[model samples]
Target: MTAVPLSDDIALRIGLAARILPEIGVARLLRVLDSALGLPPTADTLERLRLRDLRQGADGALADLEPERLKDALAILRGEVGDTQPPPLPEPYVEGELPGSIRVACASDSGEQLDGHFGAARRFLVYQVSTAEIRLIEVREIDDGRAEDDRNSYRAGLIADCQLLYVASIGGPAAAKVVKVDVHPIRLGAGGEIREHLRALQDVLAGHAPPWLAKVMRQGVAPAGGAA
Candidate 1:
């Protein structure tokens, strides 16, 4: 998308923000800009404006949005709900510890595959993936008895302790919601066995890990200098 150029200061701030918030793809950035600043929704809009315009527009637009909508928008801009880190994860595979455990949740109809959407799914099969092995943690039942203002975020909260959420599909807002809670969402084209996903995650942990995962790991990793 050909977005109008921003001034140097704005560009620098955006670049730095994008470094930490990888989910803010160019498409999303443009969409947020249009939504927040009243620019044309399409990326090819010819409106020339500076970052200050975007900032002002976002601040004003945010005031009118509902809380959940505001969260999604802020997530787009800052990369997280409030930039607060999750509790420290345990080491890669601490035998009985939860500190660095990489817990994952998968939405499924049969409780066996990634077969459900975040909004419609009634349950999630949880797993703990470590460098050496993957184990079934538990079956997380979604509380849909009552209606929620933001179904996506509500579902994400169901597996708040998890680091990743796998589903057959997810919308952009749902994805953002999970990302806000420090749970990276993964979508599958079709349903697959829960074990298969765990195996794949195990393989990734054994290897060098991707950029997103590397960052996730670093978030859990403790600083050597902090040791007494």
Candidate 2:
């Protein structure tokens, strides 16, 4: 099959969208786009793409996908989902201000929820968390313009300061990149409110932390004074 030529911008969007849509890869998505948009897909075609177009073009390719996930994926292709205006970050935190805290990065698409895959998240919501407090310290938007080959590495570097990363899903290679940067990846298969995970971390901070977490805390400042 002759490969359809895609503009860089459209290609980047499709790449990210493919990651958002489970079980769909870039090549399959391109085939669907080719069928739906006819020949090479342009920015206009992508913007004009609708759910019906996707369904018709998919032709069983996406039959098993959840409706909402498909919609979100389509929205990404249509440029409706992104870090156009990122979520507000809390007051800046100096390192020692949250001495017992460890920095965490959450893969979020909508800001409130941890509902993004590592490779496709719109932004990384960075937080400083301890037993007593969880504060949003930074919001790092993904730079989609980076070359595709090193994009995963770039994303890993985005939150290198954090000791832990929370994502709804992450590929093994991407998770390996994250771990290489000393950030532990935590997958919440059923992604939920970011605060809920942080609060759970707080509970762990308040009690006997697991060995891995204890090591992380020691690397940073220290665990909560009373932590076992």
By lDDT, who's the top model here? 2
Q: Relative to the true structure, how large is the alpha-carbon lDDT of every model?
A: 0.56, 0.77
**Model 2 local distance difference test score:** 0.77
**Tens-digit lDDT track for model 1 on 72-113?**
233334322111222222224343454545777787656365
Runs of candidate 1 exceeding 4 Å displacement? 1-100, 221-228
The window of 10 residues in a row where model 1 has the poorest summed lDDT is 80-89
User: For candidate 1, what is the TM-score?
Assistant: 0.53
Candidate 2 residues 1-228, lDDT tens each? Answer: 587677877777888788655367888888788778876877787889988777778586776655555666776788755543447666567768977789888988885688777766788888889889998877777775652556568788888888999988776777888999888999997887899999999999999999999999999942211100
TM-score of every prediction relative to native: 0.53, 0.67
